[model samples]
Target chain A: MFNAIQHYRLVQRNRNRAGLGSWHFEWIYKFFLHTGTSRRKYLVEVRQYDEHLYTVDFYAKVHNVNRYRLRTHQHAAGKLGATVLAIIARTIQQDPQACFGFIAAAMLTETTDENTRRFQLYTRMLELKINPARYKVEAFAENSTIFVLPHGLVSQPDALQNTITRYDQIFREVF
Target chain B: MTKYSAKSSKKADPRQQAREERKARNRAIAPERIAKVHIMADGRKLLELKPVQIPGYTYAF
Candidate 1:
């Protein structure tokens, strides 16, 4: 659990280092649904947009899933109008609902064995029944910057670029 | 004629069953612990630190 916390902190540090200083960050510890005694700490980043409010909430998780807790989180997402960023320490579950925001946002995974490899979710692409080729690049986001053709995604530079660009655009348009 | 019924034939209603399940769930969930911290360039301080418990609200630990 502490490892997960440290991972979340490191992600926040990286985000700060990436020159995204405008987003204000806060740490929130939400109790896990299955074992109420254990709490998962997540970073909530808030940015102001034209007298409106935009917020992003993300969690760095090691493993396991709790349906009730996620449903409760959905309430928070809808209530706060925040985007959910689900970062896993390993592979993603085949069940889309296992990870929060699987429908709209991409999921990122980190594999312990790979040193330089990063992976971004091709979920959206796969949902469209289109196959995206694997493109390898040293991207800044999740697991392997190289596109792994798991299910969905078109490895065309534009499509892959758009997928990568959405990371930033979300923060921009959410406002 | 008077109808005869057994006293043990009474079954728990769905409402009562739901209440029991809710109680069980409440018992299983733990409350959350929280700490408010204030940070400065030189150092950091914890302004408030404790478990959060609200009256008449679900508490998950």
Candidate 2:
């Protein structure tokens, strides 16, 4: 918890150093409740500590594949899954009263591997089959908004800020 | 019953066969190496110079 606070501070510092004035940062704390049921729905309690710090209920593991590479849902091939769809589903099921919602992901990469190619095929297939928007199926490049701070830069405010600024540019392009 | 040889097969087209073979080969070729570049908050560029070889899938189920 203390480490998360320090990391949040570094992120704020990084954001300020980059002069990304339009972008806003907030720190929040979230607690998860386990409702004993078959449904995966859980209660998330969000507490806003300050303007730039916050906590999340969960963190998805960083994809090992390159940042520039797009991934699709290929279970055995290790491609990107239908993750955004799942997130939307969970959000709908989550307790309605929660204040802040957060999602974190690692940086994108350039190289494409066998898994990535497989995932791409799946994405294209889905695009043809149905309205992907209904399921929140967007391209990985377009979907990247959060760049989970790399460990080395967690303390380096300037570096983290610059990286995030770059991501902001990327998100802007897709948007 | 042997189902393999019992079914009647249609004549295959030479052009279609060639196209399928080419498509398979293209799919097998690895994509070009593209580095993951990052700009530090200080405006310095950081490239992932060393690619760590992960042994297995990062998740289960």
Candidate 3:
């Protein structure tokens, strides 16, 4: 399926096309992929980990896609780490008590140290076993919070705002 | 005339079916062992850079 959130390759088209503003909370959690008769949900946090992969849940049907360009000379086709994570938090708030919880926070520690520091905020606060330079799994299921660290990462206000709007619209439409 | 019935083969071991389903579910969560990235350039502008593996939480690839 040619889905916006492509990693999960969720077939939500035609007979299953996402309704208008279907990206919202209530409608999304209804799927077997997100809710699936569980009391836990997943979240994402991305850092400037690399170019293509931002950070996401391996099993879950959503992958972070960067919309904003990095400050460097690299193309911006990758998932905007921060905004993707924010969308994840919105997805989790959908139920707060029904889905099996997992978090997909990531950082690109390979290209910059700033991402490493931002991620440390969560690791130090939540005491997560973070080894950005060494972590490879794109899915983790332990902490209540996730962070994204990126190398040569630059903050984008528009991306952050758009992410929030996506969540807000999702909340309004679904609930 | 002998009637052939599909119901005779309809019964499956529920436990085994459940196990298989669980296996399928677990398989979905696996991450790509190797994440690949390619940066394309068009003149002075870099065209693309994206990770070819799953996003977020990092585990042993």
Candidate 4:
């Protein structure tokens, strides 16, 4: 579990590299009633938005479906907000709560256009192996950065970067 | 809900056992050998110095 800075940096860098102007992103915390006929589950929704930002819940940067997110969040909520919501998702499991194995974050596409982003997500689906494939990239456009979320994301490039390096020190001390 | 600590201690401590870990180190020890080194420019203390031999260097005995 590293700092969220690197994640922000990469997202910013990717935006710059993709020539999307000086982009800005903030982490949001939201929950959802993830139900599919046979299975009923809760999911954590994370995303980043731009321009005239306002507090919202169940907001959709995509089409039709707007997820249930927390409204009126503190500006500093950041990645921590995303993580707490993920924990909620893990706990709601009936048979196996927190039993999805390793921690991972769903890369909700850093590129533009839903179709193209979905294709990118599909082509590089291996990176999303650890993250839940529930939400399609174009389906939801939030911060496309990494969080020490309760899913599978252990790649070098797909990692969250932070200004602080205490995680290593913490690992050394704890492990 | 046991705990993250409980699951960890089962295989920690020993690995985190703090030893005199060489943080940063380098060695310099001159060995007995005939080599050209700095001589006294005063010409009074000019003497043949030996070559420096570092530790862990293999030598034909």
Which portions of model 2 miss their true places by more than 4 Å? A1-83, A89-119, A128-168, A171-175, B1-61
Quick one: ranking by lDDT, best first? 2, 3, 1, 4
lDDT of 1 at A23: 35
* Model 3 stretches with alpha carbons more than 4 Å out: A1-20, A23-154, B1-61
What lDDT does each candidate get? Answer: 0.28, 0.31, 0.29, 0.25
Against the native chain B, what TM-score does each candidate's chain B reach?
0.35, 0.32, 0.33, 0.19
Q: What does candidate 1's lDDT look like per residue over A73-144, in tens digits?
A: 322332122112222211122222111111123223322312221112222122111111221112222221
How is the predicted docking of candidate 4 categorized under the CAPRI scheme? Answer: incorrect
Minimum summed lDDT over a 10-residue window in model 3 chain A is located at: A45-54
- The TM-scores, chain A only, for the candidates as listed are 0.24, 0.23, 0.23, 0.18
Q: State the iRMSD of every prediction, in order shown.
A: 20.4, 14.4, 14.6, 32.7
lDDT of 3 by residue, B1-61 (tens): 2345765656798999999999656533223322322221211211111233334644211
Among all candidates shown, the one with the greatest TM-score = 2
- Indicate the residue-level lDDT of A63 in model 3: 38
Per-residue lDDT of candidate 4, residues A21-126 (tens digit): 2223323433322223322122232222232111112232333232222222223233333334333233333212121111122323323332233222322221
> What is residue A170's positional error in candidate 1, in angstroms?
0.6
Candidate 3's residue-wise lDDT over A20-126, tens digit each? 53322222221122223432222332211112222233212233352111122222112222223334434334422211112323343324322233332322222
- Misplaced by over 4 Å in model 1 are A1-29, A32-56, A59-138, A141-154, B1-61
Q: Candidate 2 lDDT, tens digit per residue, A1-175?
A: 0011111111121232444433433222222222233212122222222222222332222353432232322221211123322332233344322112222233245242323443434333333322222221222222222222224453455655544555445334323
